[model samples]
Target: MRVHVHPDRCIGAGLCVMSAPAVFDQNDDSGLVVLLDDSPAGADADHARKIAEHICPSKAIRITGG
Candidate 1:
């Protein structure tokens, strides 16, 4: 699946990072969401990405072509 995070809408809640560290991260200075892996592979990564997208308070995470 393809995952994307909107930096402008991120609230720095860290839910995405906590859910999927391999796929998501935060900026050190701004603490906004960062896209570590836009196209994550495997079932586990896909599940984690879905969790991160669901838990994002600002809905900053988006998944496409899943």
Candidate 2:
């Protein structure tokens, strides 16, 4: 799977980081969503990424090529 994040659209909600820390993070200064892994490996990571995508309030996370 491929994951993409739009930091400009992020609201710093941290749901992505909370749900998928392996694939997402927050900037220390901006508290915005940070893309840790564009293509996370393994099933567990993929599942967590999907959850993050679903819960993102600003729809900043996008997944493709699954």
Candidate 3:
């Protein structure tokens, strides 16, 4: 699976960060969405994708080749 976050659409809700810290984080200055992992692996990978999709209010995060 591949994950990407749209910086322009992110609202800094922090939901994605809270859901999957290993996969998402804050940019500090702008507080926009930051993708920590482009390709997550192992057991936590699926969990990361699910949480990211679920919590993204703007739908900025998308999963491809699912």
Candidate 4:
């Protein structure tokens, strides 16, 4: 799936990073959501979706076509 993170909407809660570290991260400077992988494959893709649809408290993570 294609993962997108909106840093502007991030609250620095870090749920995305904790849920899917391979696809998301927290900026060291801003503590905002930092997308580590825009496109994930296999199980990583599913994991990204979970973070986007459920885990992200700020709704900073979004997923598109797989």
Measured against the true structure, the TM-scores of the candidates, in listed sequence, are: 0.89, 0.89, 0.88, 0.88
TM-score of 3: 0.88
**Relative to the unseen true structure, what is the Cα RMSD of model 4?**
1.2
Q: Ten residues in a row with the worst lDDT in model 1?
A: 41-50
| Model 4: residues with Cα > 4 Å off, grouped in runs | none
Off by over 4 Å in 3: none
Clashing pairs in 4: none
Candidate 2 structure, TM-score to reference: 0.89
lDDT of 4 by residue, 1-66 (tens): 678777888999988777778888888998998887898887778778865548778787789895
**Clashes (N, CA, C under 3 Å) per candidate:** 0, 0, 0, 0
Better of 1 and 4 by lDDT: 1
List model 1 lDDT by residue over 1-66, tens digit each.
Answer: 788778999999998888888888889999999888888888647665658888899999888885
Instruction: Pick the winner on TM-score between candidates 2 and 3.
Output: 2
Q: Between prediction 1 and prediction 3, which has the larger lDDT?
A: 1
Best by lDDT: 2
Q: Scored by Cα lDDT, where does model 2 land?
A: 0.85
Residue pairs that clash (backbone atoms under 3 angstroms), model 1: none
Q: Which of the predicted structures, 1 or 3, would earn the higher TM-score when compared with the native?
A: 1
**Candidate 2 lDDT tens digits, 7-42:** 999999999888888888899999998887888888
lDDT of 3: 0.83
lDDT of each: 0.84, 0.85, 0.83, 0.80
lDDT of 3 by residue, 1-66 (tens): 888889999999998888778888999999999998888886447766677787788988888766
